[model samples]
Target chain A: MAQIIQIDRPVETSKSKNVIRKTMSICPECMKILPADVFERDGKVFMSKVCPTHGEVEELYFGSYEMYTKFSTYWTDGKGALSPNVPIDKCACPTNCGLCSNHLSHTGLGNMIITNRCDLTCWYCFFYVKKGLEGAYVYEPTMEQMTAMIRTLRAQRPVPGNSMQITGGEPTLREDLVDIVKMIKREGINHVQLNTNGINIALNTDLALKLREAGVSNLYLSFDGVTPKTNPKNHWEAPYTIENCRKAHLGVVLVPTVIKSINDHELGDILRFAQTNIDTVRAISYQPVSLTGRMSKKEREKYRITIPDCIERIEEQTNGEVTKDDWFPVPTCSPVTHFIEAFTKKPQYELSIHFACGAGTYVFEDADTKKLVPITKFVDIRGLLEFLEEKTEELESGANRYVIAARFLSKINGFVNKEKQPKGLSLAKLLTSALLKHDYSSVGQFHLNSMFLGMMHFQDKYNQDEERLQRCDIHYVTPDMRIIPFCSFNVIPEWYRDRIQQKYGMPIEEWEKKTGEKLEQRLYRGTLRRNIAKHEMNQMACATQAAHIEPITGT
Target chain B: MKYVYEPVKGLERTCIRNISISSSSDTVRLDEPVDFTVKLSVAGGIRDAFTSDLWEKAWDAWDKTFRMTYNIGIKKVVAGPITKDVIKSQKFVRRATFYWSRSPELNPDYSKKIWVMVVLEGREPVHPKSVDEAKTTLFDVKKTFRVMGSDLGKGKHALKAFGKASWGRHIFGEKGNSQSVSKEITITCK
Candidate 1:
């Protein structure tokens, strides 16, 4: 028998001038879809929903109403997946989501969990040893299951997901991690990112090199803050981990799970640190922590930090180097896909996601002053982009390629002003060549001078919007050959993550008895003595180089 | 038609008059048609002083064909690569040239000299030395150009256009005079 749930909401009052928009939300307790009102009060946007059994619930939907409106313009509908795992008539919207035909976006970044077993027990983590112990299941997928998951992701239509992230309680716990990476690469996945706490990489340098050699593109390292107090999980070992990544030539993107009044204050410090070690640190993705576990309304308010709050804090802390105005929602690039499709007359890859899901921008280091420069400083990006959109229309209207190319050349100068561009940057030439000639060598040159700065705020049950779920492009592929959106999988674990894992997982005692080895939680306390000694020796070498090198007086 | 010298008060000064510009729409999609119409009146005809005397004696030197240079400026209201310093210090504009011929018989060589001039905004315009160089300066000859949309960013944008004319010397009319009136429109991209 199908379980039924009832949804209810309070009547709107005449004084509700704060309501910005209306959407659908799910009950945190009953998971019943309900009509929700999005309102603005105290400069923050909140979504209020009512479930008959669960009562009323209100959660912070957005930190700023202005930012929300600004981001809302970039919304676009996505082309549904080609090979949907679930039939449209099978069940409800989210419940039947094996990426059903109703989903709005293609999988941009697919996540595959290798194991549910984690080394440490972080109080804030969604998945921990306690849940596994209580659930009486070891939710680690076998090698076959992992491969099937990857295959399912690749089978997505229009364009296969070229990028994938291997995540877990700790993916590094798997002994065959290098082999797994190799298999993923062999399967033609262009980029394979590993999400880790950075303990194993710091302890074993060889392991880092092995993973890199096996085709691991980069490391999404957990780095909440610079100090041990805010980031107690792997504070002592982070530096060593970063040093190893640098040596192994594996780029690291610091993933900070920001909680309000906790590690939020250290955002600017983290950005500065990333800049200081710009050689190996490619980017910093500040994930405002999602509340999925049990918590009170007061607790939620105390800890919830939205994307706008993070942007504001960064601007304040960075002294306006990275301002609130510099950030843009992730789906702003939808027009690019639109233009490409019209120009090429073929189906193309698109980022047709909800406007409020994420925001990002690029910052380049000015060679002359060594100061951070936002990309907008030198290019008339808006004009060039508008011109491109116009040109794409001309192409679709039967305008010849020569005519289109000619138009591009003519308007290129208007979009990129050479004189006001960076001292060494030739934006006009780069843009012309890139747009007309299709030469991307200049794009590589641009990356050499710039770094990506972005943030993604994943939805939890309290603030989950049905619209966001329908447009979500980031997904996790379960062993059941199902591709579920990240929010649907983790936000309501019982419906997806836990349900699938429980069916495949074994009890910890049973596993221990079968393997004849007792399982224990091993917390990484820092680097080993040898690794620390090696680090000191390298530091001494650099110091010696600076000290021994003198003026040519002796010569 | 041959060049006819119109004796007027601003005849010697050479002035451009009644400049007007308009776009097909105030807002358009990224890959949609956007037509622009530029209408202007030219008076006080003059010729380039650098022409050889022999050619000047044989042809009507005073026959003026307005050489209008279109300047397009774009300001992003959303986050983009353009910085505040770039916006403040530089005129975020690009240039393309168009010529409205008054009398073809008066200057038979006008077709050869009607090539478009592409100028990088905020920089001194460098004269093209060859046809290839001139071709490189131009993407299209028409006033309308299409917008190339991408996934970089999107928001409200102010697209503006102004023009300058060339007679004997580059002529930019006074505030309310013959200068080409600048046109502006707000475009939104999604």
Candidate 2:
């Protein structure tokens, strides 16, 4: 028999209401339960306890108190749903758009949309750029906006000063590109640059001259193949021919999006074009499409190619003079492929190449010099967007004239001597000398680990072939700009990128304050000591083992 | 070997002091210290040649001691100039054999034999505060015996003889354990 007690109920009269809110704290490391009211300050949660081994576990915070328990369990098992209660309100499109802070941290490269319109729509475009996908007016910018963006860029300086690359369906399609360049120069962002298809420069020599006059230093030109026949359409979307590129008088790096069936056999022709356009054309970068975008999985598979195969083809065509082993991985994009110059016969030395999947970073060894070098640069597609938004004020200036002039002259020079141009030092060779000189033994190996960590960010599996990507520290970079305690091998889904950008939407100012490490300084300051310490600790831990001894007398 | 003794009530103090040895004491031999003395003597002239090994034994023992203290290992000690300082008198003396008196006797078959009696004596007493300059002295009785009608040089052989003696803790002078019984006798042809 159960005893039920019923107290006197209020006679349906409502006067006041009393509400009780319960809170609890959690341990991030072990997920042990703790009461909430222990320590609370500035809307942050904390708890302290002495573990059995006398390990003093310190404070921890729960961004959303209601979902703390759920998060604890989720992190432990890598399962469970996100904290829906603590909804992200900053960014407009959270889950839908992939520019969240978390995603940005994982994707070290910044995004720069040169224009809304594109001349050719590749089926495997990663940006979801389709026929009707264009946003806003193509090439729409006021001098004020450009200037303002430039100013913001200067103010929100990132660590390890990165390059700002303007890219679109074709940045040249935008008439104001020259003006934009001028504004970038006027704002004194000497590193301002663009990624483009050289078509406009080839058709309009005057436009090229103007762009060169604006003082644009380098050009990441989309020159996918040597011949139009390499494409299925037998088509070349870029308006400029190899001749026009020479005339541009700019340091043009030939960016080729290698398609497996179409241009896989044209390695020789591509290298030949590069050599012919020597001084004006710096390096030929072969990029195999990641097959992300509006294309179907089947279609992507049909067209997707790899960088290794290209390296092999180059070796075979050049009779081993240019081989795959000679190529060195780019610090930022090591997993995708390597970069090689015309001169290196399996070069064994270099400056330094780094991979930055946010702060999860690594550098690489030089194939020519076999030296360990620091990672000097990285790519941040989202940061580029932030740059465009911030530096809108300096979009127009007289300095733009020099950029256009340089391009025009370089292109004209090439056009005149298209057949028998004298070969010169390649940009890859120069950059190798400048950025990658191995300063210490075993540094190359550490850099390789850092690179591997970064590659792990993009894909779940380790790409051993990517020398740098296989060796980088993967978990160092965090969404709030704080580096992880060490590189943790926790898997981060690509979808998280969209969520982070949408939720935190951390501005550059906030990033600097939170990280306590100036972003721009990372470019010059090497983190070799930290890297070496980590390696030493890893080695010691690996070698330590238990031992037993017994007395010979058996006493 | 054990000896049996029975006593009556009045003879209680007269008990047997049995002395059992694994072998005869006089039969024992020492390999070193050839110039040494023993309580036993040769039974005949021919016997003296067989057991007269004292000079060799003494020389060997002296050499061993000298080697242990010097002339070996990393640090070698070479004998310096033979100065009088090295002839210091021994603070105490020990002997393996007791002092003995010997008398020669003629025998048949052209052989000779000797009768000997062992004796021991204490050294002369001296004042406590005498200026004792350390010096050694040897008995000069060499002229008492002759072999093949030729005189042996002054007691050199006797002086060279050293007894197979054991080191002692006390009685640091010439007055201890000087008398004992002789096991045999010796004779030299003249």
**Each candidate's TM vs. the true structure?**
0.70, 0.35
Task: Indicate which candidate wins on lDDT.
Answer: 1
Tens digits of lDDT, candidate 2, A1-555: 222311111121112211111122222223222221223334433333322322333323222222222111111000001211122333111122221221112222222444434554554443312323222222323456445544433332122212345655567765678777876667665454566655455445566557677876666766556454553211232323334544656566666666668776766555545443443554556664433323443654466444444556655864654544343333312211111211111212111222211212222323344232223332232222222211211111112433433433343222222222113312232223332332233432232222211111121111111112222222222233322211111112233322223343334344447657433432212222233465442321201100011111100
Q: Which stretches of candidate 1 lie over 4 Å from their true place?
A: A5-15, A89-91, A417-445, A527-555, B1-190
DockQ for each candidate? Answer: 0.01, 0.00
- Best-matching candidate per TM-score: 1
| DockQ, prediction 1 | 0.01
Q: What lDDT tens digits, residue by residue, belong to model 1 across residues B47-146?
A: 2221223122212321111122333322223333322211111113233322111112222332212222334433224234344454334222224333
Which regions of candidate 2 fall more than 4 Å away from where they truly are? A1-111, A126-143, A157-162, A232-241, A293-301, A332-555, B1-190
For DockQ, the strongest prediction is 1
Give candidate 1's error at residue A315 in angstroms.
Answer: 0.4
CA lDDT, candidate 1, residue A452: 79
